[model samples]
Target: MSERMIRVKDIELCTESFGNPAHPAVLLIMGATASMLWWEEDFCRLLAEKGFFVIRYDNRDTGRSASYEPGRPGYTFEDMADDAIAVLDAYGVKKAHFAGMSMGGMLVQIIALRHPDRVQSISLVSTMYFGPGWEELPPMEAKVEAFFNSMGEMDWYDPQTLLRNAVDKWRILAGSKHPFDEERVTALAERDIGRALNYSSSFNHSYVTGGESYLGRYGEIQTPALVIHGTEDPIIPYVHGEALRDSIPVAELLTLEGIGHELPPAEWPAIIGGIAKYAAL
Candidate 1:
């Protein structure tokens, strides 16, 4: 694997890749407030072994990527979508299979709609549709809502406090099916916080706005799509996956039973297997 900084417009994004560049490319976009490390190195390697060139990157305001003032992102969600294209361009890849989680999934949808030619296939995980019907879908569970609301009270600057909050967030999102791996979660949180340029800037994702309306446009996507959602997802209900599957012409849903809004180590094999099959790599 190799890591490099690639320029996109005026900002630089940090990217890491696995496997042969000659193989089919799969760009993995992580969720909001998360760096490429959330994609997990071992997960990327396992996917690479399936004959795919896997690319994962830090989105703006996370990890080693560019950052802005905490409350002012200065870029729209659409610009972030364009950043994906820039990453592909930096790698000399004209087209790639895209896999994204949570907010990353939303970006994939935008890319598929806005730049169809650059996408091969899409994998949307633990996210809801962004268009018109989104309001009708179930809201996040009460506990999850409360947790996000409570973020204002936490101290983001202190490493120990940040670590504790991160661990707590993961625990809440892990659902009831599997045992919560506190040790593993804590270690990852530590690394993510340790490697960031300005970890606090990640919160800017909440304020990002898009210039265009994607209203009722899900049906316009003709590319093959795989919508993966945890049955127990608190942030985005399972029905959102069903909505994507039904709206997209060539989309299929992969239900992660007993899982939550997370990509736990236990589910990596299944998730990887699903992607390999879906991408036909």
Candidate 2:
């Protein structure tokens, strides 16, 4: 059944809880500035069907949850990890499987590192470990700054805009032959940003602040982790996934040769299968 109106540290996060509550829980964390809605209905249902009590919530600054300012120099990725942990505490959950995408993946890494006792396993998708040389990680300084700064929101009077946007991003991060499904891209844009502002200063600030960068600590994780990356992913190079796999003990890697940075809904079967395999362990 769907759950509603859960409180996580004063922020009213929208959560969807399904399947047996008695089963071990799986926390579904969305990417940076992305609403929990972007997790996609079919994928969430698939996880629920696997005897997992799934919980997907909006981050503090995204969706229906509270948005706090950096409120000092700024908030880092560690703060995001704390937010995820706080959600589990609010639910009174002792431990859970952690799944995240993009920045969400980084937060899950932090959560596993900081609160290892609370994690059963981890599944990270389209992510990177920002080891040393983060400031110099290719694409030139000017392009990198502009890339993070230009994630503006858009309206869908013409759906092609969304397709164009996805293609453009993939082109920059992946080579031209890298394929991305148009429908999934549109759905992601619709579910996550169809109603909210296109961009947030806080998200931009958080990115530049290096809150999501991980440097040389992947070997420290003791949990089972499944890292999935598209071979053609543009935004996060596939090398990031390989590095994570090499760092995390017992971590398995899934590389989709034809896919781009955006993993499509059509691939839910394979994605859910990978998650289920890890969750079973």
How does candidate 1 score on lDDT? 0.91
lDDT of 2 at 155: 38
RMSD of model 1 against the true structure: 1.2
Q: What is candidate 1's lDDT per residue for 119-160, written digit by digit as tens?
A: 989999997875667888899999999998999998887999
Candidate 2: regions farther than 4 A off: 69-74, 132-184, 194-214
Steric collisions counted per model: 0, 4
* Worst ten in a row by lDDT for model 1: 210-219
Highest lDDT: give the candidate number.
1
TM-score of each: 0.97, 0.80
What is candidate 2's lDDT per residue for 192-228, written digit by digit as tens?
Answer: 5444433242254254354434445777788999999
- Cα lDDT listed for each candidate: 0.91, 0.71
lDDT, model 2, position 84: 82
